[model samples]
Target: MPTTTGMKGGGYYDANSREQRSASQIFLPWLEAAIADLPEPPPHQQSWNLLDIGSSEGANAIYTTERLITALRENSDLPIWALFDDLPTNDFNQMFLNLFPTGKSVIPANDVYTAAIGGSAFGRLVPPASLHVATTFNAIGFFETRPIAVLPGFILPMRPNPQAPREGVQVSEDELIPFQKQAHQDLCHFYRARAAELAPGGKLLVQIFGRNETHSTGHGICDVLSDALLDFVEADMLPRFFYENFIFPASYRNTAELIAPIESERELASAFRIEQVEARDVPVPFNDAFTANEDRAAWAKSYTGFLRAFTEPVLAAALPDGLPQENTIEKIYHRIDRLLQDYPDRYEFHFISIATLLTRL
Candidate 1:
């Protein structure tokens, strides 16, 4: 499988295909519920306009449009305009074009100029006070941190501290605190900027990843490995290797931590009101056929492609100069493979996520 070396945001989304699938399932139901709560469409202005932020491959956009159309078919005059926006690096335009070759039911608009979290207004794609609704799935959380490790190759001059022992590189309390503060600031900026574009009475639905206190068997192994890797860095066992190879460079914030930034954003305070906030534990089950036949090996290999893409480079850059890249890769693969092999019957992966429905006041 191809790695995330050239992608933006350190290829965080590139890992774990299951994560995307899980997000899709979770968001679809929430969206349906939100739409149902809205006032009935006006007879003269039966049209609805939707903007999807961080629409990676446009699959979610397409799926959402399809569901809305099905639900509102009684109003034949109701027209839907769907806009899929993402970073310029994302192939959203191509994905939309391919999916809607005829361009009959779907209108594809690209809003790539704005940053994921915040930036200039999207005046070109969305006129002032024109959008009826906006939705983001698993995207808003990214603004919490600006993966510093993924900076351009030219900016690679700042190497990891070398004074630490071979076992791990020591990161001072000073360094860690600043990093956390910056991440919080970035997240607040993102929410405030997003709140500005929303039209009064419009709805914004967001679902994002969050940190939880509990850990599960499916995720425990990977979490332990992540902790071990961090330990190695603190000991200076391999400073450069640790910095380069860590995939999930940013940490997940718990529900309270995630809510604080949005609630405190100055721009969002006056215009947007939180309508509904819901939290749930969703466990994704692997396909029954794959597990029934005991083809756990294939499932693990397929799933690990995303995991490796996310973690390999980060791990490689953080290890000591002497650690072989190929060996580390093999070790990660073998560890995951063994886990799957040992527990072939069922592997339940749980995600604790928040769904917030914000209405423009």
Candidate 2:
């Protein structure tokens, strides 16, 4: 199976991405403010390019880009070309359909042209100095490749499982240094790549699941999944190696980690000027509804479906090649469903997000 960092496709991500959409919406004002600050393109420039780097299935991206086009039009009639980019393995067909919902350019009336590019954003995918604005939402947490083969007892390197069988074998702070280094490296590479793509004075907005002083993203959801995987291992339904080797291909960085590269790296500091860096816990829609109605069953399913949309792709890819992938995925998610339903309080997810707005120098 091809290693993929993209979300689950077939319209699933777009359908079940309420949490992501909510978190992304929190930054819209910041994005608009950044757009307002954008310097007008040179006199010879033909059009402005707005790019979404990790636009999975293009639902949220389409809406966000349309708003951006509308915002830009308020100032100038610059024809805007909006680009949605993700992994080559991502469901580009679904993205395109969403990009042009009426079998034609939905935003043609606004002079907004849309297209999808399939590639890794960690590498340069667009012409140098050609982009005007770029945004990456809930995607920078993912590693370009699996950093480690085995992370005993926990899928997320930062969050340890207290109920793990090999208690002390769980990942430790000292062991996480390498992973921290990897996160730094990944961020730096991403910045360098965007630096090459964006014009001077271009705006870049980046938002990803993150950790704050008190809260971290995927708290309840990942913990429950880890417990379920441990249960599978104990039942001999899955080999111990599978449990140890399986890891969510993402990392949640704190505020310090998120801005370290620009603060410390000479090249990054010179290439971009940081406008804002903030981290906070965004409200979860299902969590809010559950808080009001106390509907365990509905909340459980909603939470699981939301998690599965972004996580199942990585989990399914990690299964042993000969195994029944679909059956295994079904079993794993079913267990998560049951666990959430039974002990709803055990997994209250927190959506901690870190966002930064920067301008190319």
Candidate 3:
């Protein structure tokens, strides 16, 4: 199957992924350090450029861009240009509104310039050798291909049980080998493009859903979502064709694999130095206020809502063409909620976050 970074409509991301604020903050220190370490450009050069990859619905954009502008101003008098990049179907209007929600710019208008760039990170999005800094957070998980058309019993490529495929999940190395190569290729493509787009001494900061080990990287969150989606099949809410062609549109890179491209690809190794690469395990909100009030139904509903906002578009797109009742989207989520309520303790997640800092050589 061809690849796609699943399209998201207005507000789907911000409303669901509450962790974006915290995740986006990870960019600040890296951005500031990169700016501080930047080589003195030609005396005549008085402007700098920054690119934000996969800026969904602008939640993280607001925090990161604000800090970015502030950081840029402290180091240089040069005006900074910020470019926000994502899929064409992403919410650009909401991003601008987020940056200037009160009809007033968050930073001095004369100090920094900002614009939205709509495109995939798999290929080039900016002018060659012109950028001074680039950042990507929680977005690289969305790969540009569907390596596995459908995992019969589950969706997560991050296996909790690595040695054996989960029940109902049909796959083989014959299928996974090529898919793994493709994911690595996609990552290499992203970095090579950055290497070309970044000026000498520039830096690229990346944070994506990934792991530090080759073992099963699966988390409770993945299980919850898979159970929810599979619950629909059990309830007969969705037909079999939906599952036959369905698969999650993400690729979670492993720890060593995160920077393998930079090491193996001569061009990448020549162009950038891996300043630091570390993985952190973050917790997911499970039986919080949503589950403590003794309202299991309410908790399930709320949890399902959270997942639905970010995933509904992709789920709906998987429906068989011309099928009716496909628009009963809430029913699917209801099924998910029902499943979650039945297994609240199992509805957790441990995010293995890979943070990497790269300096252009």
Candidate 4:
């Protein structure tokens, strides 16, 4: 598999999973915060017209829409209209079916439509200055690799070296920095395009896993994997295999790192202003049964499954050769299982969710 420098694949959440649901739980409170900040609807407009960009499976969209409906109904205002949009590949129809089955009122008046779009296709689907609010939950950070879409640069130093196999193709630290920078730049393009699509008064709310400045010490299991891979590359031992088998398939940024490109892009333009930026720690409580049973097998399975599904494929594709299709996945699974047994504490993952409300200037 040849690695692509740009956004190459959809993440795991694209398919519904329990971990995805768990991760999304963090956004419930954030959604409430965003709705509370919304300006009062105009006197004549019957309801708010909302656009949910990158609405994967429409979970967040449905949840937010329902909440807005409750708020509006309490005020005796008309119902709200919501448009759920995503890549054409997303199952918007199914999402609608699931959320609106038999008129549950997840969407008041149920005026929902699906707008399928590409990275460059947003302008065509949304009318200029038409939406009251636009939200993108855990999406919109991905950007295409083309030069026109390149984001600004940033340095992500590799973790300290680990033991190496000691032969074959070597990796250079200098090269990885550029790769990391390009990744950041690409993400900026996606966010800027999203910002451009919003109406003047319309707000764009984005939620994504971000790097925590306080916690990013390259010590977590994810960090250890990165370190081990970089060491393999530097040692020139199975570098190609490492890239093909691991990095490309499972790479991701911490909250701070993910936010850098967006903030950089904002600084370069005055067209959109960020209204709020915040981060909070989310801890998942695991009972004694969760830890004691199956040698943490269930926990490991759930954690790695989510990581592999959402984070791996893209990174795998981005590598020089990408993940091998043969028995490689099975091997990788076993390798992760072993690692989990060795490092149970590292498996206690801490995620940073960043919420930004951007208004068109």
Candidate 5:
């Protein structure tokens, strides 16, 4: 349960998790397979335990948990006890309110039990071998704490290549290495924790934003925000160092990075068996909608809203301390929107989503 976007107000993710929907669509088939391939539980098993890590306000969980229950019924009619874990700051009230029309656990016919757990996903949330199936979305890669002070300059995670940048120098070698190591450590923690929580042969299905290649991560919207912040510096509205010192939280893993920890370490190597690892090219939400509705203005608005939901918390954390958060957040999005309107296609989101299916051993 990593800290979700937007620290203060709740519901940013619930309202604007467009990317999650798109990513989940791409992962639907795999999700089906993961559930279908689950090892049949022992005879007379009366109850099943399911965990939804980083379950933000319940829209995704309500649907995903239902899907899981439906699949589970195929094997046995045992009622499921679903645990939705997230940070304490999350809107659990909205979550349960949305699920139970009568504010009760029994969902008419489904009969699946549900509850909420609040904490960091980096640490263990449940007792060992307690969960039968675990699912997480867009929640991996975030460390409970900022590992170190932000790199000398740059508010977001910027890994400049060894080569030259046409406008300026890339993030130096010292800055690049630490950034990557921190991400790896965070990911290891995530895998190790899940390994312990899941029952032997339990299923784990997840969709994490990642890079396909080693050179760069899938920074579809992040780089755009970085450039937009730099534009503010150029426009003299915001200072240069604010742009320079902005360090974004979370990691974006590549395929190689994803496998390295599992294959290299003996204990972790034996923790789980990977069934599928897919690197999908996620078209920005508006780009796909634009082809259908064909409204540039509408597309621009959707794109801005998507970025605002997903990145606003990071933006808030990056801003200079004591700045007017509400107003400044608006200005940042407004500037980004203006840039998009000025040149409609100048920037298209470059996103690569990684979906993995593993069975805990």
Candidate 6:
């Protein structure tokens, strides 16, 4: 297995992450509700600390936090420290560029100090009970570590795409059960860490790509990527071993899986009260535009760019070091683009996310 590097860096992720940004709009109302009942800061604290974990490249996360901080400012005139956290390998420079463009703060008024912290999202990064409000949007679906060695048949463990058929590449429940368990364990770790960091009566909002009864975020996208790689293997351009060893280390959990730890674990149950838990589908901007204009070429490029922005870094890492890595990766993406253009409706993407708002007890 390849080492876990973060998303594509140096402004690439920020440029192509429209789907993620659009999906996060659902959190605005939930965030307002959380802020409406936010508790006062501790006596010793000088500044209100708001933490954003899994903050990728910064366009989406910054937009969300700006609104959150602005809303918080309306209630009180306390100094706010907005902190962004992500993996060490993430594009922090690019994120800082986005946050502090023109060398000005994200929120110019009201003592708002913006900073970045580099680390894993699964562990505690701040002092105990220091955070007043915390959020993670369109992140946390990724496991901190790869749970299983090799996903034998499919690129992702989610239910196979009914639209893109793979005759021999079906994942059974037996294979899927362990993956689900790992996802549950990861969610537990995340909540445990957040529970420790949040102050008494603090609000924590976690929203990530997830599955519902009707749709999953990974269904069509992963299937298409899997098919594109298989085409290269059949043409003798790539080795068979590459396909077997490559597995995306992320899982989309259902609402039951999202809330199971809070209900089952004694520690979590004692520490927090669930304010809301729900899963819903959000509109895909590129897909909607495609529907409106009926422009196949434009749709293919936009959709493929979004897919490559998130998946390409990991895909590049999975390749053998000796082979022309850049060219091979480009070929794969190009193949995907051609495939999407040829059969525009074959692989359609639907965005569904599970969200939970919790209050520390």
User: TM-score: which candidate is best?
Assistant: 6
How does each model score on TM-score? 0.65, 0.94, 0.87, 0.66, 0.88, 0.97
Q: Please give, for residues 198-265, the per-residue lDDT of candidate 3 as tens digits.
A: 98999898888776564222454556656665656667766665665666666777757889999999
Any runs in candidate 2 off by more than 4 Å, and if so which?
Answer: 1-5, 161-169, 321-326
lDDT (10s digit) by residue, model 1, range 119-150: 21122335555556777665554434344433
lDDT assessment of candidate 4: 0.50
Of the candidates shown, which would achieve the greatest lDDT relative to the real structure?
6
- Report every candidate's CA lDDT: 0.50, 0.82, 0.70, 0.50, 0.70, 0.85
How does residue 242 of candidate 6 score in lDDT? 84
lDDT tens digits by residue: candidate 5, 35-151: 766666665666788898877777766777777777777776777788998888777887877677585654444657778998777789998878889888777755556665556
Per lDDT, what order, best first?
Answer: 6, 2, 5, 3, 1, 4
Give stretches of model 1 more than 4 Å off.
1-18, 36-47, 72-76, 101-127, 143-176, 216-240, 243-247, 287-295, 306-349
Minimum summed lDDT over a 10-residue window in model 4 is located at 146-155
Using TM-score, rank the candidates from best to worst.
6, 2, 5, 3, 4, 1
Pairs that collide in candidate 2 are none
Q: How many steric clashes does model 3 contain?
A: 2
**lDDT, candidate 6, 1-361, per-residue tens:** 2135778888888888888887777866887767968878876897889999989899988988888887887888889999999988888999989987888876666798888998777888898999989999877888777765456788887768777887667777787777788888888999899889999999988888988998889977887799898998888788878888788778888888888999999999998999998887988888999989999899989889898988998898888776534598989999999988887766888899788888999
Candidate 2 per-residue lDDT, tens place, 1-361, comes to 2246588899999989988888888887887877877888887878999999999998888877777787788788888889999988898999988866788877744667777888887888899999999999988788876665456757787856343233434677776776777788889989999999999999999999987877678577788888788877777777888877777777898888888999999999999998888987999999999999999988988998998998898887777866534487799889999999997766767899889989999
Per-residue lDDT of candidate 4, residues 1-361 (tens digit): 1222222123334342443334445655554555555666566665577776666565545666566456445544545566776665555555666566795644544444433333232234465555667666655434333222211111123332233122432345654665566557655655566555555556666665544555422224354344344444555533444343443211245655545655565452465666666665544333233655645776666555645554444544434544334444344555665566566665456555556666666
